[model samples]
Target: MKSKITVMLVDDHAVVRAGHRMLLSQYENISVVAETARGEEAYQRYIEIHPGIVVMDINLPGMGGLASIRRIHGRDPYARILAFSVHDEPLYVTRALEAGAKGYVTKSSAPEILVEAIIRLAQGDTFVDPEIAQRMVVQTVTGTDPSSLLATLSAREFDIFRLLVNGRTTREIAEELCLGYKTVANYATQIKSKLNVRTTAEMTCLAYQYGVLNG
Candidate 1:
């Protein structure tokens, strides 16, 4: 017998969540148990509902989805999170994976892609959109030259690296991640030492060249 799949929705838009709920309702094999707009609530709901799949958006208004996914996965490594977002850019996709997301699907995808992501998650497989997957493979081989330059960075260092390359100031990253300005500044120093990059602009240039930002 095919067991029904339980899904939890985490998107900031009410109408978008409603639309997903309505669409998933058409499939007898899937159930939408809970929905949340904030990252904190999504984390709470995941624990309470223990849904088979979690469809989340990356750019939540509060706390952010990618960070939430990392926290949730830390608590429950078995949790299945499929990032469904309008941001199909490689940076978004790569960050989601580093943060422990199991699947990545763009919101602009056809309905079948959504269905396929859910099914793949249900079967305990990682899912990435075809375009994203191919890009990742090529980057994995060619991205090593400069991308691996940061191999020694800690998780926090990597976070700082990404934000810096994207032109976020230390003050800005601190505010976004809820850390004190000095705290983020400290992370910047650590990242530079680990990556051997002397300046933020230099790191940004390298990040672009190695497809860390482009991918």
Candidate 2:
């Protein structure tokens, strides 16, 4: 008999989870055994559920998904996690890979790619969305990038940066991304340091100068 691959879904939006659940329902080998809307919840549940694969979104309610990934990896180094997000930049892609994620699939990709990613990761193979990979690799391998310095950000830090550039306050970023206020603040600091900015206003100015807002 074929063993079923236990999958967990972690994302803040309820509708996205519902849609993902429905999409996975059509696959025979993949079973979404658990789901959570926050990174902290997913981490706690991951210890209990021991799913074969965890599909995680970078932006979550309590802890950012990357932090949850680190926690889960600390407990079980061999844990198979697939970073699932809308972020298509090198910062996110490189960070997910650095954190031991076996796969990276963008939300904009076809639903079929999600299942394909799960299957590939469950088999202990690495997979990255083709379109995202292209976008991510170019900037890193290129020289003298004056853009948003996105190549320097990790997955979680990039998540915080996105919210900040999109007109979200630190408090609002904390609430939207499901992180503690202090944690969000720290991420903001790290982002500024990476981009060499001293203030949020400077960060925003650089964000525009780098064309990330247009991105």
Q: Of the candidates shown, which would achieve the greatest TM-score relative to the real structure?
A: 2
Stretches of candidate 2 off by over 4 Å are: 144-194, 208-215
Colliding residue pairs in candidate 1: 90-215, 91-215
Question: What is the lDDT for 28 in model 1?
Answer: 96
Candidate 1, residue 77: the lDDT equals 94
lDDT for 13 (candidate 2): 85
Location of the lowest summed lDDT over 10 successive residues in candidate 1:
144-153
Global lDDT of model 1 = 0.82
* lDDT by residue for model 2 (64-138), tens: 777778778888989999998776655566677777788898889899889988998888898999887776567
TM-scores of the models, in the order given = 0.77, 0.80
lDDT, candidate 1, 66-151, per-residue tens: 78899899989999999877766565676788888999998888888898899899999999998878876777778743345665
| Residue ranges of candidate 1 with Cα displaced over 4 Å | 89-91, 141-154, 158-172, 191-215
